[model samples]
Target: METPSTSTSSYQRDDGPVRATLVGIGLTVFGLLMANVLTTPAFLFDPALLEGLGNGSIAGRTLALILNFVGMFLAGLLYLLATGRGLAWIDLRIPSRRDWKYIVAGGVGSLVFLFAFNIVTTLLEVSAAESQIMEIIGGDQTMILIMIVVVFLFNAPAEEFLFRNVIQKRLYAAFTRMQAVVVASVIFALVHFPMYVAFADSLLSTLASLTVMFGGALIFGYVYAKTDNLLVPTAAHAVLNAFQFTVLYLAIEYGIEEVQAEPATLAEVADAVWTVAVALA
Candidate 1:
């Protein structure tokens, strides 16, 4: 029987619920600060250095993304060492046959949650805010391609490693599984507030955006709790993101939806892609 990659904890945690929660939060903050610091150089960034990276035109963007991911990765590694844990403490493994069932459910469940959330928001007359990540991608074929790769390699793995394996796991020391999932989800949702706030029309919109993010966190958290393999949620998150970019690319590329609007429909997105394929063929 093969086990996931993990290490036995040298276990010295003495903090109570409140203090322990704070520790997890501090790690999140540290990661963000470090990522920002690492990415700052991209502001005056010249693309010439990595001119032929992901795409020549998006060289600077690619560099910034790499730095940002590196910063977050380093933060997690440093914290792991500081806590007397090793790299192996982060649990990752190949998905077993049963694990794939949960992974697929996680991805499909997320989409369903999103659909239901959109309906509720509309029913409540809550105006939605533009997603910062989507706005950045903005239906650009090149940017979307870059993001598809980054989301799989860096974004999903780094975020899941920190929030799920590190933060959520730490909370288990002082809280129940449900409590830990909720707390970690709250942190996950709140961290996205800055991005949402920028495009928010009002407080309601910001809150709405956070609600969706919170729900997403919950979905991802639920999968981690069920599977216990960090790679499961990472794969689920990355697949959802990849599907979104592909759908969104088709939606906007064919004028089926505007760049700034939420995708109108998946059926339409697929239809557009088929149309293009046939035309090209």
Candidate 2:
């Protein structure tokens, strides 16, 4: 398929595959460090700052999320400045009704991909890694509700802007749309390696998480490549995350057990089905 937007700069047009891949990896690594690594300093800077901000505390989660948001954009800004690029490179725009079609497709596709991947890992005797968000919010209904907006307003936008808009787009200089998307997706997934290491119980579980994240990243990259609209992937990402949190919130409200990212999850599968049905309608 022809990509709607092509890299137009002389540098973009002239870069070779090896250079593009290396630079893409570098940018992704830098972005990850900014968002994830910088998070540790909160405790080091002042232990008092962490008084009410740990794990299940709303204050802690919110602060971490806010810092994450700032970190992503901070790295992106520096990258743009150092590379002589502009904000236009990471095109952020309001979606039209037409764009919404791609957004919904991307969102539904991501959910379905995640469910299927988890199921496959289970069959292979490896459980998928649960999202850290589940650990953060726990049974706090207020935090669950807060996450719905945070993922959309802060997390999704920051991540999509750095990963999809910048990192994935950078690969366009040397790769086809599909190839670029795949490569970028891998990088995006690996960026979460540390989280998996911290949260996953075994190597297989960590791999499963990386695999599932890579698949979801593929959807994010493809929709952005197709529409050349950053918002498509951003909204899709927000939908994917918010969907999980919403499910947990509802489960808690109904006094159900804590949800985990496991195979054959009836709630997720059912909700995804409903999403597809509505999308198709």
Q: Candidates' lDDT values, in order?
A: 0.73, 0.72
Residues 160-189, model 1: lDDT tens digits: 888988888778777776788899999998
87: Cα error in model 1, Å: 1.6
- Candidate 1 Cα deviation (angstroms), residue 26: 0.4
lDDT score for residue 226 of model 1: 69
For each candidate, C-alpha RMSD in Å? 5.0, 5.0
- Compute each candidate's TM-score over C-alphas: 0.83, 0.82
Give the range where candidate 1 is weakest over 10 consecutive residues by summed lDDT: 1-10
